[model samples]
Target: MLKTILSISGKPGLYRLLSSGKNTLIVESLQTKKRIPVLPKDRVVSLGDISMFTDGEDIALSEVLTRLHEKQAGVAVSEELLKDSDALRNSFGEVIPNFDRERVYTSDIKKLYTWYNILIEAGITDFADQDEAE
Candidate 1:
């Protein structure tokens, strides 16, 4: 079965969509390779994952949790369960974690434009130099 894996870009452990018929999420320990099954209805909480304000594709954790709540899905993991935990996964049907992208990282248009020119000057985009605007 195809599983959607979710994880911090630099983290080791991954949250995987294992089975959905019963709404189960599989949290796998990348180091020990241990698998922990989590249910959406099991109000659970976790800590130490260290997900930051800029996590989840620049989206905050609260937003993700909010969407989950609207669907009647339990908070799933209680804070007690995740105090010393490593990671989490979503195993709902067609598990596709939504993300909020209203805010983007700080950047200067002039700086970015200049940087793009630098890349072009360095011949990084040599193949597609058909239009400098690109």
Candidate 2:
């Protein structure tokens, strides 16, 4: 699930891993369904590999997303909330109460919401890894 989804730096949206070659990985845009080759120089990060800073320990992105889903009742984050930095902080606080305020910037919150909404639109409500779920 999250393992196959990648975030390529400099790309506008999330991409789904399609295939791999010797020096490039094929990826399909989750938004437009367009296929493109990700070169070796491109910074590609798997969604599963992302984590958020917390007061005690780092929390996996999947866990944060799951908490967000439950908090929002699986609905997309509101545009109004997204626009206000304070509101975004407050909302994320509700999702992850102990999230490190100093480490998690407003931009990170915005990106998290954007990615969550995109995944919801793509009909991917399950954020947990299959092995973890079992």
Candidate 3:
């Protein structure tokens, strides 16, 4: 689920990791269904490998998303929250109260919300809970 999805630097939106090549990883755009070869030099990162800075320790992206999902009662995040920085920060604060405000940019919060919406629309929720159990 979240582990197989990726966000490449300089790319437009999310991509589904398809396979690995000699020098690049094959990925398909979740939005357009178009496949592309991503180089190792690209800042390609699995969503699962992402974590946010917290007061005690960094928390996994999946955990943050789970908190977001629960906060919204399994509904899509509001558009205002995505567009408005102040609202977005407030909402994100409710989810990850200790996320480093100085380190985490407003753009990062917007991207996180957008990615969560995309994953939810693609029916990628079950795996987060499973990852927590393990």
Top model number, lDDT: 2
Q: Which wins on lDDT, candidate 2 or candidate 3?
A: 2
Model 3 CA deviation exceeding 4 Å by range: 127-132
In order of lDDT, best first, we have 2, 3, 1
TM-score of each: 0.24, 0.97, 0.88
User: Against the unseen true structure, what C-alpha lDDT does each candidate score?
Assistant: 0.33, 0.95, 0.86
What is candidate 1's lDDT per residue for 1-134, written digit by digit as tens?
11133343334333344444457666654334567776665543332121223324433233333333444243233433233222212221112233222232122212222322332333322211123224
Which scores better on lDDT, 1 or 2?
A: 2
Better of 1 and 3 by lDDT: 3
| Residue-by-residue lDDT tens digits, candidate 3, 45-81 | 8887889888789998888988988998888887877
Error of 3 at 97 (Å): 1.9
What local lDDT score does residue 98 receive in model 3, on the 0 to 100 scale? 90
Best-to-worst ranking by TM-score: 2, 3, 1
Q: How far is candidate 2 from the true structure (C-alpha RMSD, Å)?
A: 0.9
lDDT of 2 by residue, 94-133 (tens): 9999999999999999999999999998889999987678
Error of 3 at 2 (Å): 2.2
